[model samples]
Target: MMLTRRTITRGPFFWLSVSSGIVIMAFILLPLIQLFVAPSVEMLRVSIQDKDVAHSIWLSIYTAALAALISFFFGTPLAYLLARHDFKGKRIVEGIIDLPIAIPHPVVGIAILGVAGKNHVFGQLLAELGIRVMGSVTGIVTVLTFVALPFYLDAAKAGFEAVSPRLEKVSRSLGASMFSTFFRITFPLAWRSMLVGLIMSSARAIGEFGAVVIVAYHPMIAPVLIYERFEAYGLKYSQPVAVWLVLISLILFFLLRILTLRKTVEQ
Candidate 1:
């Protein structure tokens, strides 16, 4: 048997690593960099001032925020359960949670429409109640929440699992109730991961287009607006709004990352 140590750091393995990293950097970073190329001060000023663009931007933020909040409210309990218990169909439940990610957006739109469109059972019932999902804000929020939930749920599950069960037991023994233990100990410790999930869910919700367009095309979100502008006016018009969306998303995403980092440090 023989062993050899390479003296050159830039050998085959090192070059391979460098090439892979460059490929990723090109794919991920280049497109993002492209967003900043156009939209001069005047163009951006005009884009922001445009009523349709403003409406779409506001709608995107509003729906994405609502979706993230909904995820936070519902996903917390699901996270706790998946972390604290084991049972038959656990994997099935997980797969279901992730189904939206794997499923085509158009299919998701069709499924939602089938159940909630004007002629469908729930849609008719809701119509009587003066609530319509088709071509409305409600539909927009519903689809965003449906598609973005897995991001929050998966992240929250991982966070809760990271929490030590022994600590929870100690809290119980010291007279803390289950709810108290979760709020006072587990939640605070898991906040970082939860924050990460919030960002991911928000991002997904804000960027959703295909599903949203099928269900509610009247009220345009950023992605839909981008598509509309591109189709109607051409790339020049669409590029400005696209640039704005990228900038806003990047800002909020980094803010979430910073908040999570701070929470981790405090913990």
Candidate 2:
């Protein structure tokens, strides 16, 4: 009688768990499965061969990589400070850091243009330096970096926060210099999270469209090119590029995962 009653209670819970699992799997996995099934191999090949498509893909990769590098170089130190230090306006500063993530991309582009366009004071300074942001690679990278910075910063900050300050205190007590202790201890400990942040930033930069379009629509990235194709030739033409982009991005995603795993293991 006890076994029967227990089985009755567990049965509904088991089915509910199965249903929740199915919903999550369907939500995440179905779209990816469709992306593969929707495009023909020949269509994907042709898309890759298309000159404009090829250019967009290459540009996307180049710009995304550059943005990620910039984020890592500048963000690492800032992340450590934010994670380790407490000061006035700290909350405000953190909120500002996250503003990019919350604001609309088009709005970000508009803001960048307002501050950095040739006529504005900052923009005029840049103009004097013979650097134009209106319709150039600089503009694209600017927008990409602006939009993607928060990802790296936030992830790195979290990673740094997770490291016990006691460890640093102990290292200091042992007579190691601050710089030496950071290099030997803190950096190695937070390296994996930094890598994760970089991967996320790169992915965000690569997929950026609204801001890139508003900033520089000429030297198209894959997302822009995909949009243009859809506008010009409709779904049939665009789907090939879409499929190609998805496949290429997925490959990159996996490579980053492997890199992250290797880095994690090494540390």
Candidate 3:
């Protein structure tokens, strides 16, 4: 009778959803919680002070920022077009943009290697320009750009979609050029989503490891550094670096949530 009454009050679907969400949240939060507590404060302090650890973290941030900037400049026009126009094969273009997220990270590394190889025309061109994509900072940045692009593109497209096109048309009808209208109207309205996307893309780039390790193992980023430390000296050495990465990632996630909430409220 009590179970039936409760189900009648809110429905079984509601109860099931609540339970499922609790389970998923626990699964996600448990490991991070354990990791945060596992390292001694002294160990974390020592890791923070380590020059290599510091360098690796800085490298990760630097490369991710570069990748984000590249995506912003190269992707914005495409993102805007996708949001505002309809054309043949547009879905195909979107699928290609999103393909990176679906492919395996190591496979991504190998594919990059093939394109950047000395025998390939594109690779030869890069070589002629004195750009080495293997075992260099350039390789790391390239790998990050490949892996992180889709997030920025998706966020940008969604943001632009949220903006009403009637306003843009009205601006153009009032004697504004397409460029002026885009910057003053469409872009201003969509900047929040673009900014969120940029940070999210950078955050994704910061956590990349498998491809970077396969390409540029030197000048290591934080994730690759964490892996190397774990392999060489075990968790005692790796945990501290992981702690710092998690802390930084958490901050990014928090900002994403705040922006997401604001976007929702605006809608």
Candidate 4:
């Protein structure tokens, strides 16, 4: 009986799964591990003190955070609409939302350029308002928002879906307005998921490179700096900045995992 149980517990499929998992995990971790250790302690310290590098990192974080914030305010209602309603073009709308992920990053920048061209009518209007897209902080935020919005919307939609509609109905039955009930019932339960979405969107924004590079390279977000350094001075110069980005990314990853784990437990 013991022998039979051991074979069942450690079947070929189990062994194969573990082997494949190990291989994939190692493949992903190898580069990150190598990067983290590439720069000497002294190099990292000096890089930290570099004002330009510090500013680049801060710009990346600030722009990403702003994009996520924009998603929250503008996206919440749309997310709720998608989650609760069965419209004729709902699937199409969702697909449209996912298009940013499917589109190439470089192409995203190009498309933004076309829209923001000084010759285009909309571009002229923006120009008239003194909002320049190329080589400006506004351009960077716009690109980040474009890339990050989908992540926030998807998460928020899922969050609203998980919430029971019966609660909303109850709130309404209690003589509460739809607006009042949302704040009282739906938002409270859904806020956690929305927060998780916010973090995800922010992380996505922070990592954007190709689009932001084309739109606002002068502002030099961390990824842009990494590319600039790598192009100008090779990996030796780039790796330290990369290390800092990796650290920030790791923090976001951990925080995301914690929120996800807690949400799972609560559910």
Q: On a 0 to 100 scale, what is the lDDT of residue 157 in model 3?
A: 97
Kindly list the per-residue Cα lDDT of model 3 for residues 1-267, writing each as its tens digit: 134554356779878877888899999999889999999999999998999999998898899999999999999999999999999999999999999999999988889999998979999999999999999999999999999999999999998999899999999999999999999999899999999999989998989988888888898889988999999999878999999988988888899999889878977
Candidate 2 local lDDT, 154-232, one digit each (tens) = 9899989989999999999999999999999999888888888988898889999989899899888899999999899
**Decoy 2 TM-score against native:** 0.88
Which RMSD values do the candidates have, in order?
A: 4.0, 4.2, 3.1, 2.8
Best by TM-score: 4
Which candidate do you rate higher for TM-score, 1 or 3? 3
Clash numbers, per candidate: 0, 0, 0, 0
| Candidate 2 Cα outliers beyond 4 Å, as residue runs | 1-17, 20-24, 255-267
Best by lDDT: 4
Off by over 4 Å in 3: 1-16
TM-score for candidate 1: 0.92
Tens-place lDDT digits, model 4, residues 1-267:
123454467779878887898899999999999998889999999998999999999998999999999999999999999999998998999999989988999899989989999878999999999989999999999999999999999999999999899999999999999999999999999998999999999999999998998898898999999999999999999999999998998899899999999989987
Model 1: per-residue lDDT, tens digit, 64-144? 989999999999999889999999999999999999999999788889999987778888898889988889999999999
> What lDDT would candidate 1 get against the real structure?
0.90
TM-score of the candidate numbered 4?
0.96
Clashing pairs in 4: none
Worst 10 residues of 1 by lDDT: 1-10
Ranking by lDDT: 4, 3, 1, 2
Q: What TM-score goes with each of the models?
A: 0.92, 0.88, 0.93, 0.96
